[model samples]
Target chain A: MTTEKMIIEIKKWLMEAAGYIRVSLTNELTVSQKSGRTDLVTNIDEETQSFFIKKINQYYPNDRILAEEKGYDTIDSLTGRVWIIDPIDGTMNFVMEQENFCIMIAVFEEGIGQLGFIYDVMKDELYWGGKNRGVFLNEQKLAQPNDVSLSKGLLGMNAYMYGKNIHSAGEIGHASMGIRVSGCAGVELIAMLKGNHIGYISNLSPWDYAAGLVLLDEFGFKYSNIEGKPLTFTKREYFLAATPTAYAEILENFI
Target chain B: MTTEKMIIEIKKWLMEAAGYIRVSLTNELTVSQKSGRTDLVTNIDEETQSFFIKKINQYYPNDRILAEEKGYDTIDSLTGRVWIIDPIDGTMNFVMEQENFCIMIAVFEEGIGQLGFIYDVMKDELYWGGKNRGVFLNEQKLAQPNDVSLSKGLLGMNAYMYGKNIHSAGEIGHASMGIRVSGCAGVELIAMLKGNHIGYISNLSPWDYAAGLVLLDEFGFKYSNIEGKPLTFTKREYFLAATPTAYAEILENFI
Candidate 1:
């Protein structure tokens, strides 16, 4: 199948899987951590990840799978495709508030992202993208955000980034028009898609950036390391995604 | 009438007024600024403030009023009763996303806070408090937060605080469990009421703090200037609010 065809199939599968997972989340019982008192896991995260794995294996048995709750499974020498999944991002928000969390999925073929999806189940906002098709929120195509300077733009950043003094991300927020930390990277990415923010900077995992990176790339937004280099599949300590102009300004002044 | 009766009346009036304002926001036509750009001000904000002002006038003709959008107005000379109001806090959030904003009201008698109310319209959650009645989220009474140390607690703070290097609030966040900044002070205070966050520090106008201050006091949360002095009504700069234990920890290590 062509890359486009694969992405379309992935999008459909994501919608179906998200709906199932959301329903289950509403009814599933929660479990606390094995070590820490605060960390929690719900049956929904595991069940949802399993459901997606099952569907992906049924469709593309050769694809490698890496998930948050479930460890990596290597598939030898069949195809160079890997599915990265975060069944529930913002699990804390999910367990306590029942909102702000999402299911993220990304398919990379031969180390190039072929498809990406972030489903905000509670808000019913589906942000998806693929090679050549551009980014989309639901059916509407997303525009690259207006060319705003760092000082004039709104930024989505974690409050901890400021506290931890990570690469001056907090300083960038002070220089911006305003700062918003919504506690969920998936939800914050949606805000970026809607032009509510000019950029988002965070310390994120593969599952966190997999879907959003594709969407940012498709929409002509810039995503990079704090030093303005392109992001790789390897885990990164910091990533910055922004409009082209904002990215340039932030890189010049802070990075 | 007794103070309890007055608070109940104000709460009911605020709820009805919010419903009216919400409908107006949904239906009213908006116009752009002469600068030829979208300058958003929903009719809800104006109409809601007006509705509230009229209600206060009819019920307590002797009370003074201080409101956003329309500055302070003195109605009577002898009575030292004042109402601080923010018809719509988080107006940007309201105009852009139609969520996370709230109606905030606080009553002071003889220069002492007597009652406070914050209505989360979309979720139908009402947080209210008074000196004698304690704090409440809807009908449930709130207790003092757990005596978690700063290292074990979460904080609600503005992300820009770090960039500005103001009060070193970000450092305090680093010392905590994690940090969250929700953009809306009213919504953030709700998190504090639930013991989800130990404290919040922000640059706030009187309206923003008016309602939250009473709730914090009733729930045994302490608020003071960044220097650890009591908060005064006239200042708009740095202030810290935290559980007593967390406050002591923060003052010792971070402050």
Candidate 2:
């Protein structure tokens, strides 16, 4: 199948996985710890990830899979297609609030992100983007933020990043009219798409940035490391995203 | 009427007011700005606060009201009953995301809290408490958090607080396992009650603290100004709330 065909298939599978996972989450069940006491992993994350993995294996037996809750392993076939999935991105929010979490899936062909999808289960909002198709929130097309300066714009950052990394956060905050942290990346990314925020910065995993990156490209937004380098799927930390103008200013002032 | 009868009547009034606000919000009307672009005063807030004020005036006749979007005005008869209300606690969140905001109201008689009610309208969850009556999330009674140390507890603060007041936030974050800011005081208070967070610190107005204060009281939690003094209805700048044990530790370590 062509890359576009594969992406279309992945998007459909993601929606089905989201519905299955959301149903399981709505039912009250005991939760277990994954990384720490606060970092919980429900049965839904495992079940949904497995469901997607099985579908991918059946269709593209040569593709590799990297999933949260399940350790990553190499695929011997190495057909240049790898699927990265985070069944539930905001597990802490999910375990405590049962909202604000999402199912993230990204497909990379020959080490380039070909397709990215973030499915917000509770709201049933799908954010999807690809190299050719650009970005989309459900069916509507997405746009990058305006060329507003940082001081005139809103910013989204992780609460810890703002608190622990005061120097960087202050520089960004001083450059922006206000700073907001809603505790979830998928929500923040969607806000950025709508111009509610000019930029969003966080320590994100591959799955966290997968869908957002595709949307950013579609909207003509920019995403890079703090040092203004291109992002790689292997390294999952410290990424910044913004409109072209804001990105330049942030890079010039903060980094 | 007896105090219990009065409390029950007020609770019913609150639920009815919430219903009115909820119906109007979900009716597919477009939202407009009143204060500023980032600040949104929805019709729901105005209509709900008006409804509650009207109900209180009709029933009590001599009570005072201090509400957001409405200036404080004293009652001539001074029957010592005062109702503090935030028709929509997270107006920005409500306008942008239509979730996580709440209707907050607290009734005080002679400077003593008589009732506190915060309604998470979307979730149909009511958080209510008083000195005599225990705190509750819907029908489930809430208990005070265990004596978790600051190092192990979660602290909630707005991103602006960390940016503008980094010294204090840095101390708080370093002393705690993590920091979370959900951008809404009512939502953060629920997290505190659920033990997901040990404390929340913010520059809050009376309307924001009114309902939350009652919950803290009944749940055996503690709250005070940054200087560790009692919080008054007139104060609006800075306040902190936590489990009793965490409060002491925070005062010693951060304050």
Candidate 3:
């Protein structure tokens, strides 16, 4: 099938997943700590991932899967198509607030990112993009983000980034108009796409950021590790996502 | 007129103010900087304040008005009614994102907070309350927020609080589940009342937080200076607005 047909099929799968999520809000959720008490995973997270895995197998049985709850196999030669999924990106927010969380999916072929999808479940906003098509906010094509520096716009960040003084985040916190912490990487990415924030900076896992990289590329925003290296799907690292001017200001002055 | 009649009149005035705000969105806004380029004042802020002042003068000619955009005389001897208004609480958010801002109004009688309102304009959520009626989101009366400790819940703060490490904000930043920066005190107060946050900590001016104080008091949330003194409506100070456990934890450990 052509990529266009495949994308339509993927969106269908996503809608089905969202239906399960919205309908299951009242269902009892079982939550457990992962890396620590503060790091959490809920029963819905596993169920959502299972749903996507089932649909992917039914549609594209040969594709490899890299899911957050489950580990991924190394793509040493970058040969086959791989699907990266984070079922519910902000488990704590999901279990506690029942808000500000999303499902993220990214498709890559031969190690080059192709398509990305992020659905903010409660807000009903769908952000999708790829190189073949520019980024869109629910079918409305997004203009390139405003070229804002740190002083002129708000920045989204994780508290630990500043509390731990990583990469002089404290300085960046002081430099921006303000900071927003949504507790979900995909939600932050959607906010960035809408120009609600100049940028988002954090140490994120592959599942948290892989989907966003495609959208950021399509939107003409920049994303890279603090060391100024290109992002790779292989490992976790400190990454900076910023508009044109902020990318230069944060990279030069703070990052 | 009876106090009950007075409250109904206040609600009508608030609805009219909201109507004016909704209609003015398309008018070209003249923006200017205050303390800095990022500290903004827009034409709407002044106009909204003027609308309220005009309506108040037409209805209750003897009462006083204290607004963010203008100063007013104190009700000498604490004997007359005073309305405190923050015409556009998050001016930067309003001008840049056209969202995340609100109009706040509070009424005090003889120096005691009697009623308060914080309207999230874009979201169309109105939160209002007082000693007579308790707090509410739209029309639903809010239950007292969960008694979440600093370690188990999120905290809302001004960036400078954490960036400067004032009141041990860095330590509190580490202790909380996370932090959110909404860039508007009234919005943060509404978030806190809804239990999305354990509390809010910041250095806020009177108009920035007076409306919230009335609602917080009605909901049994606690507000105080960083030094654990009762808030004096007369000056700017580092303040803490908290749930039961967070009040204890932040007071005894962090603040």
Candidate 4:
């Protein structure tokens, strides 16, 4: 199928998924702790993942899936026709604030990103794009944010990392215009894409960064592990995404 | 005027002022530095303040005004009817992202808060209320948030205070579920009002905390200076506002 055609299909599915999630929000959510007390998942998250999986299987039968809730053990490498999904990127925010969480999906072929979608369900904003297609928020095309340096722009930070001063995260917060913590990787990436922040850093899993990395890349953002190494897409890693100058400054001075 | 009648009048003016600010956003903003580089003021801010002052002078000529841009020198005490205004809270956010900023107003009578209003321009959300009127977001009446403890909920923090670990701010952040910084006091207060955050701490002036404190008080929040004293509302002071449990916990354990 053509990229545009696939996007149209995916958008429909995403809107439907968001509708389900929104309706489910009015009902009681079955929440459970994941890695820790701070990490959480809800029944809605699981159902959303199932919704996406069922659609992909029904349509793209041969596409391998790696998602937050399931299918991770079945994928060993980023080989051909892989789909990465994070049904709910900010589960705690989902269960608590009912905002700031997102549904993210990225399609890859032979380790290259082909399409990406991050749906802020509550806001009804779908940020989606692909290689050579540029980027867009809902129906409007988005422009590339200015390449701002560390001192000139805000940074999105992991609350735990910033509080603990991990890797001098607090120092980096001081060096920038300031730091904002949204407690959601998807929301932070959205802020970065809108030029509200120059960079964002956090310990993120493959599902957490997959769709955002693709979208950010399309917007001319530089991203990698804190050590300036490429993400392996197989595990959780300390991640950083920023404009060129901020990325270089952070890697050289703070990280 | 009766309290209800005054609220209706204020709401009308707030909507009109918001309309003007929204229209001006499309034009080039006359931005200037205030106190430091991070502290900013724009022509819109000044114009909005002037707008409020003009209305107050025309309608309630005897009432005093304390606003961000002007009218501070003459108010020696809060002994009479007074209106405290932050025509544009989060001016930096306004000058940069154009979201998250708000116009805040608080009316006091005989040293007691009588009414409050916080209008989030971009989101078009108006959180307004008074002592005995109960709090509200737009037309919907809001309920008091759960009295969650420090360890159980998110905290809104000032980036500089959190980064510098001022008065153990970093330690407090670690004690909470997490911390969020929206770079805007009005936005943070809105989050706390919505139960998205349990607490918020920052150094603020009369205009910054005045409106929020009134609404928060209506919602059963506990607020005071870091030293556990009353806010004088005449100068910059270190402040904290939280649900009762979180406030007590932070004071007993972390502060």
lDDT of 4 at A146: 97
**iRMSD (Å), candidate 4:** 1.4
Which candidate comes out best when scored by DockQ?
4
lDDT for A72 in candidate 1 is 51
**Residue B23 deviation, candidate 2, in Å?**
7.4
RMSD of 1: 5.1
Ranking by lDDT: 4, 3, 1, 2
Give the clashing residue pairs of candidate 4, or none: none
Better of 2 and 3 by lDDT: 3
Instruction: Please tell me which model should have the higher lDDT, number 1 or number 4.
Output: 4
> Residue A180 of model 4: what lDDT?
82
Best candidate according to lDDT: 4
For model 3 the TM-score comes to 0.94
Compare candidates 1 and 3 on TM-score and give the better one.
3
lDDT of candidate 3 at residue B45, scale 0 to 100 = 88
Q: Best-fitting candidate, measured by TM-score?
A: 4
Tell me how each candidate scores on DockQ against the true complex: 0.30, 0.28, 0.54, 0.68
Q: Candidate 3: misplaced stretches above 4 Å?
A: A72-78, B2-9, B19-28, B73-78
Candidate 1: the clashing residue pairs are none
CAPRI grade of model 2? acceptable
Interface RMSD (Å), every candidate: 4.5, 4.0, 1.8, 1.4
Give the per-residue lDDT digits (tens) of candidate 2, residues B61-147: 977898886555223332487888888898876765566788898988787788898888787888887878888877788776675
Ranking by TM-score: 4, 3, 2, 1
Better of 2 and 4 by TM-score: 4
Give one digit per residue, the lDDT tens place, for model 1 in A1-255: 677677678777777777876676558566657335445667887878888889889988877887777465223331488888888887767765567788888887777777888889887888888878777888888776666677655688866575555798767876776678767789888888777778998877677888887787777788887787766555645888988989988899987
